[model samples]
Target: MDSSLYALVEDLRGVDAAQVLSHGVSSITVGAAYHRARDVTPHGRTRVTFRQDGIHFPPGDLFDGLRLLPPVQRDADQEPLKALRDQTRELGVPLHGWAVFLHSTTLGLAFPDVTQENCFGDRAAPADLCPSNPDVRAYAVALGRAVARQGMDSVVSESLHFGMFGHGYHHERSFVDLGSAAEFALGLCFCPHCQARLPGAETARTAASRLAASVLDGGPPATELPTVLEDYARSRTPIVTSLAADVADAVAAEGSSLTFLDLTGAVKGYADGRPTGGPAADSAWQIGVDPSAVSDVVPSYAILCYAHDEDRVAEDVAAYRTALGPDTTLRAVLRPGVPDTTSSDHLAAKVTAARKAGANTVDYYSYGLVPLPVLSRIPH
Candidate 1:
């Protein structure tokens, strides 16, 4: 089950929440480090919770001497994670930590140099930290170590890859109509670190800039770019794979495992859950996530199977299973509520499908986001 500190602390109060979560799930994955959001908690003490972009726990010495440091949330004083940990331990349930890395507007705003700079030399999405930057990599390692040291069985790493152009910003406004291809080109980072690391960076930047400019001048949208774009995307894999390896090593050293969460499935199925594509895994390259390369480094992987259809969920999981191979652990994350699930039976079917298709474990999307009754849809 996926949950949040606010949900455990304010909604069900530590013990009761842990007991409730432990019912139909093998383990509870709580948000230890998260990004900014104002979510409506249907069954929470407060109807809505405004979460700040920061780590929920005190990072004490974890980020010491690092150029980039994580911001601590105000609710850290309540020690929600600690309380949940204690409750879960008594209940004989494993607790995992969910950490959102490389996607923080607070850190980006504080240290603009670490944020991704687009081809036009603009920090369009200040929330996205360039993974190519050494400081960002160090911060990711430190975050994994800190969360692992908190007694978490595994750290579920989210947003550890690059961000897209249309997302990750607050109140973002763009009057110009840029198609998906153009937006993607604009999202490509041309920062100093990326330029130094990415091969043919100058050529790729020029091509991306021209593509965006052509679209801006009322030209029809182009679906594909020059071969340089393909080469540029391929080159980003090594950077992300290396970062995942470092985080996995850090987490392993701290006696915990690392599960890299790929958001490609969520992006494809979050809306209607009727995604029409080859497979979510195949499209992960757009975000700099190479599943096969990451699997070689990280032992476990998690993919969001947000589709309503059991077949769709199975297809997505099967693709990841093929990419990661049989040895690597694969967890399928499903949403048991509207747009993705119609009822308990529907959710159960999806779960069974995912397992049959090679998912080692099945996890629900969230606790507080949906109604209390909706959580019952989770298959035991």
Candidate 2:
């Protein structure tokens, strides 16, 4: 199995790179573009870092067919990605660029029209850029091509589809009893761009609005999604597939492959350990993701195995293996510490489970977020 570790630019300092490399990791997935992060090191000092509106590295003169809404920024002095890329190359380890595609609070807040609009007309989700929006689509395409141009062996795409209401804004305090289904209904984008694609979008919007309103008024828990809304949600599959195709093409042009990271399993695992089976596995549809459909577009898929139980993580990996078929490259991402992790032994067991479950590769979720001692958890 291919062994890799996810890392931030700052993690390339001093002997940190050498230390991680000593763990027998074959590749390093560096975060080229990302969202806000709050991490604590072994020293007990916690730091929260936020990016304004751009990439860690300097951009090329032209984006070819891709475009950015607020323009891409860079920190030349740090040259984070480039420096890390060189460091990994010297160690004979391949470097893959990890890019956060659509979740941009800065650009979304700046361009609310392109942001996702809930059924209740709440465009408060500043971190979620609507996939149906033409500009956002172009931006994602551009991001993939740009990251590839940085000489990465592969590009791991994150948040490439629809984001929910639970993902955005700050200091959210909800006392209302908005159940999962109602909250999901309210998170549906009713923007003009989305409406133009679905035939009965307006009707679905009305139904969703009523359901959300009922829940906000302290109604019973929403057990299921309205049929109209469900159909509307499924319609997002094609949009996401097309976007993936564009990104695949962009990555190909740069001689780098695209690895689509499906967040559906992670979503389900985090929100009550419900298995993503039956109509629920299709909940990925709600997020504009259809993993099986995208397999034809991208050559590889990285499924999130964030569940607490090692057995549960194995099951999640097996499901993706079955869905993506035998030929598609399947990689599993594991969080060694924090959240659910207890010890390095726990991480080792999970890694063994992933490999036995038919994963072609296993990758650690992050390098900077976890402390140095925890970083040693990667099984050599």
Candidate 3:
């Protein structure tokens, strides 16, 4: 620790800085998603899934595609149990205590009601959790506390909302629910809870479309376009982050820092060419997907995920740093094996390029797939 940082840590030995700025730039982040989950069979050691769940959850979500930490290790005495703690203190890496927030896909198999509706108001479409439900919140809070007590320096509150694989892509022209959307529609949550918490979700969704329409054409942003979109962002993003704040608070109250991880994979595609199809609603959709929103929420730490690429990934990191600004903390998550076509040189270059791109911290996704020895060569 730097002299100043040491003094600060000493001064606030037990401070819940999840509510304040986090420490350090020599930061690193690694998730259970980066390793293979343990599996067993009656006859021999068979491959087993350590992921959150399988197909048919979250309306096209696949946690299994990502690595899952072995459930056994989460218990005391497991190698990972000590390793997780040692890694953080030794390396100054904050182990983002991540859980598929309200993502009950796997848990839902036994606890059916755990599913939260999609932004479109359909609960059956995918496995999520009802944020309005006290039960879901309680369970997540319990999980958060569990991780915080495990010597984790920071907590990364992931999946803390009502969304699925195709969040805005499924928006209807005039449709408000998940499955139903009108041509110019920007799909939004008319969910009972959302309506209860923020009555303006519907109106804001409408305004988003109006603004989108103006922006699509040659209409000047000086008109109602910019104002409407800005209102939608102000109304929407903070509410979601506030909800995230609540989750972080649960963990922070136990003396851990809470970081917010947004789904960057989706954002990358959208920036690339994912259609801006309907209404002036990109910002509204961004409310759920952007790193900039992470800063708005007051998370001491922010995680930015990006798909593998030559140019796009670095550019994504650069833009992320600019958007998150200096006050907020940020982490860059690079998905290393999704394509598996990258060369050794490409991987090394990407890692170096990410830090140069201004990522305050760095982490990798999808474990066993990264070729352990090759990954071991990475200088964390």
Candidate 4:
């Protein structure tokens, strides 16, 4: 079985790289474009031992014209990526660069015009970047090449698609009922670039407003609006696919492959520990993700199987395998602790189910986030 573990730069300071390989983990996916890391030293919890820092790696020369945000300020001696890559290579374990592309509070706060604009002409989400914008796409391509140049054999892409209202800002309060239609409506992006491609954008915007108002007034949303809104959402599919192709080209040029993770399953119900079906399975389209269309362009498709039940995890894996088909690599990511996982045996069962469901590779959600004992939960 091909197994890989995800890690943050903070993990390297406390956990030994040799220990990770000793656990039968053949590959390590380190955060390259991560937003933040809360470090916990080996010593017991103390005020001095805890610290939070954003931007794991430093900015390089390739990001000159990208109009991107500068990485979190660091001391002159900090060099996390180079150190981790060198140690992992010496241990004979491949290092895959983990990156978050579109979701950025830093960039959105710095440049609000490029952030997603909701139906009510609200630009409150500073975490999401509009993929339709030329500048956003250019920056993503540059980031892809930069990660590859850092000696990563492959790159894992996250948050590259459309984002929901709850993604960016913190301390949110969605007091209204916000039925399914209203939720989708509230998440739609109607920025200038989005409107340019959507011919019926005004009509869709009106429908979203009405649906949201009805929910806010303690009433059910009209049924007809979801279909209309979905049509508008689907219009952005080609643009998303184009951006994926551009990033793929960039990664290939630098001698690395791209593994695009489809977070739709988690969005549907996997994260809630429930089975996903019907319209929820297709919700990836709302965020401009048509996995089937982009399967040929990217080398691998990763499915987020954060569900509780092993059987449902297998079912989700099977669905992704069918969507991407046999030609593309299907990787499944599982959470080994917290709400979904109970014990190592339970984690092992989920891993077995993923393999039986046609997963080409199985990777865990994170390393530093989980306790040292939980690392034993991974199947060898």
> TM-score of each candidate?
0.95, 0.92, 0.61, 0.91
TM-score of 2: 0.92
Number of clashing residue pairs, candidate 2? 0
Which stretches of candidate 2 lie above 4 Å from their native place? 14-16, 43-53, 64-74, 271-282
Q: Tell me the tens digit of each residue's lDDT in model 1 across 214-249.
A: 988889776766678877977898899999999999
lDDT of 1 at 100: 93
Better of 1 and 4 by TM-score: 1
**Tens digit per residue, CA lDDT, model 4, 93-199:** 78899888888777888889999998889998887889987788888898888888888989888878888765566447876766667777888898898888779
| Most accurate candidate by TM-score | 1
lDDT tens digits, residue span 45-93, model 3 = 2233343231110111212332221132232333342454464466554
Top candidate, metric lDDT? 1
lDDT score of residue 298 within candidate 2: 91
- Residue range with the least summed lDDT across 10 consecutive positions in model 1: 1-10
Q: Judged by lDDT against the true structure, how good is candidate 1?
A: 0.85
Q: Model-by-model lDDT, in order?
A: 0.85, 0.78, 0.45, 0.77
**Candidate 4 clash total?**
0
lDDT of 1 at 44: 73
Worst ten-residue run, lDDT, model 3? 2-11
